[model samples]
Target: MSVRPPGECTAPDRRCILVIATVASFLTPFMSSSINIALPVIGAEFATDAVLLGWIQTAYLLASAICLVPFGRLADIHGMKKIFLTGITIFTLSTLLCGLSPTVNALIALRMVQGVGTAMIAVTAVAVLTAVFPAGERGRVLGINVAAVYTGLSMGPFLGGVLTQHLGWRSIFLVTVPLGLIAVALTLRARGEWSTPRDERFDLIGSVVYGTTLLALMYGLTLLPEATGFGLIAVGVVGIFLFLWQESHTESPVLQVRLFFENHVFTFSNIAALINYSATFAVSFLLSLYLQYNRGLDPQAAGLILLAQPVVQALISPAAGRLSDRVEPRIVSSVGMTLSAAGLALLTVLTEETPVPYILISLVVLGTGYALFSSPNTNAIMSSVEKRYYGVASATLATSRQVGMMLSMGIVMMIFSVVIGRVAITPAEHAPLLSSINLAFMLFAALCVVGIFFSLARGRVREDPHRA
Candidate 1:
């Protein structure tokens, strides 16, 4: 069997790795953004309630976060290439199943399957990329990978809106099938594996603890201001403390809790990521609703207006990534948080009469801030770890992002329940919906403002491999 030698790293294998990783990176966000635009359509067809509609997004993110760290550890033990390929196969098949789903529950279930697949891919993708490229070039490639994510986001709404408007929402899932197949095929061509020890015991107890705790916490958040919600949340918090204690003692923990305590950069970067995502993931979802419900625009036109942010993100992420390699990631990421906070604060003033240009400008500001924050923050986390810890570190960062996404959605769910109740959105419901959106933006802005300090508190990255 022909294999690319480990020593041969300048171009051939590196380029191939980037292409495959970029494709995988693009696939999930495209599905997510496109699906967010289609949520109203899906609700209309199924006659679903608001709470269940929110679950369309929440279930996937919750599952992905719960499984990410475990899958990352498995990849570290078995082989990244194998795990990554398996994830692609599962994702492609699940996407097919999603297209064929006949009910809302069925679609949500298959999305959970897809979420498991996503966790696998997300955990290994960066680890594989990091393994292929040296540190000097790592930030550049990672930025490009991040750019592909934004590119998917950039196109998802427009493509999803068009497809949903014309061919139906099922087509959104169907279209991804071809792209996913190509990713699987490309991954198949790659040779070799990335795993260490080859015999580390899988931490089943830790996995159970982590997954249950997250599920409780996120699900509880969705039910906020309720008695059971508070109960569940309190239990979940205690569960987290217990999980940390268990991990500190485990011989082969699913996640190394100690890393967060030991590495300030890794810890704070992840904290910033969590806050940034919590403050941002729902922007597209909320805006889609606002444009369609309040502005009386079609999905296609609304998608075009919503395109401003991610387009900027796609264009600028690589440059920001490259910039991190030269300067301290903290400075760039902190500034990004500041910009993000400003943009979100602007969004708090949104009203039914808010102009098209104003919305576009806000998206641009938010996207630019995201571009600056994401790549550099990611660089800080990945670079701060040992080579053997790359898989876990990558998974941890992905976890932070996914958890934040879940929290973002949870906040939306709680607000909708309290403000609008569990009803389908209509013209008459516009005022309450607008109120909810405004309040959400205000809360997010405040959260991101706090993220600025965390981003800065990370201090300088420790570059010494020995320290890692």
Candidate 2:
């Protein structure tokens, strides 16, 4: 393997690293949504409840979110390639543990460990890519990375379903091992030194406080529907306050508080990402459940049907990213969000009797909108900050996505539970369940409207002055 200087790789060297980053990023989404198709099967095997099942996902998400900032900091301190390789190794080991887990609790614990590895890779992947590519060509390269992510997300359900149905749920975790090994090999081949290392200290206290707060908040939200009395609300309020106070005083805050005030583009872009992801999260999580339980579709069929959104997103993200480089991101993102809102609003009318083609069309529209919005919004966020802060900026963007997805799952579950309680029927009852599903979709559509406003506020930033 040929070694390249930091920030000055040969074409083949850069391409190699880019491929590795793309594959690593792909694993994150694959882990995220692949489990959804297998959730019911896993639940049956483990005799788990909805709340417990939710943790299977929440554990991974919360772990990944909590670790992203700190891991980014670590990457900056150490080397990106070194940290990335270590992360991939750990991720592979964790996947083995997950496959061998004998109980739901054990699986959740292993999933949390897997999430830490995922975060390490995710937080560093973009920074590595940015470092490898020249500024002028970065947009096109990053666009390809975005495309890979959507492709992974799109294929996850189908892959998971096929493995679960044919082999077993354990195969979902087992299959990732080979991919992780490939990522590690590529990472080693792409190794290079760090260009700069700051002497700044890691905010250990801030990380602990932030992690605790997010855990409490997500846990409280997850339990809100089932928890009676004032206990749940009290916990959530306390957690929020604690998080705020800790972040306010920390010298090196994990989440940069000042960024929210300093840059309108960053703030608005993050808000748009939050809302947009929340909408997509609901569709991914709930639709699988709806198809499997209500429509009595097998996991494979459900996964196939769910492919509409991701397939559309994969096709459009690269083009949208490239477009944002020429035109104003604000206009492009706003139009995309508006389209997403419209598509979700259309979902409000879906029923069990609705034809599969209609459902696929609606999802395709939603995916197209998401693809258009995601790349531009991400480009805006990444470009808004100084080059030195790229790692933190990427971590912040990812955290916004995680928070949105977590909130979406919690809120939707609460709505579904309340809707079920109010009616005298099971969720399998198509009419009443359809009404609840419509209500959720409408709520998501309203969120997209908010995202549109935020997207409109992302002011234009010119390309880098130092670019070749």
Say which candidate scores most in lDDT: 1
Q: lDDT values of the candidates?
A: 0.87, 0.79
What candidate 1 gets wrong by more than 4 Å, as runs, is 1-19, 132-144, 188-190, 194-197, 386-388, 462-468
Lowest-scoring 10 consecutive residues by lDDT in candidate 2? 420-429
RMSD of each: 2.8, 3.8
> Relative to the unseen true structure, what is the Cα RMSD of model 2?
3.8
Q: Candidate 2 residues 181-224, lDDT tens each? A: 89888777764653355567777877776677666667666555
The true-structure Cα RMSD of candidate 1 reads: 2.8
Task: For each candidate, give its TM-score against the true structure.
Answer: 0.92, 0.88
Which candidate number has the best TM-score?
1
Task: Note the residue pairs that clash in candidate 2.
Answer: none
Q: Which residue pairs show collisions in model 1?
A: none
Error of 1 at 340 (Å): 0.8
- Residues 1-468 of candidate 1 have per-residue lDDT tens digits of 344444455577678778989999999999989898888888878887767888988888888889888888888777788889999899999999999989999988999999999999988777788777877988789778877887898899999989988899899999999989998988877655543326789999999999999988878877777898898899899999989999999999988889988888888899999999999999998888788878878778888888888889888888998899899999999989999999999999999899999999899999999999998998889888887776678678878999999999999888888888878777778899899999999999999999999999988885534235
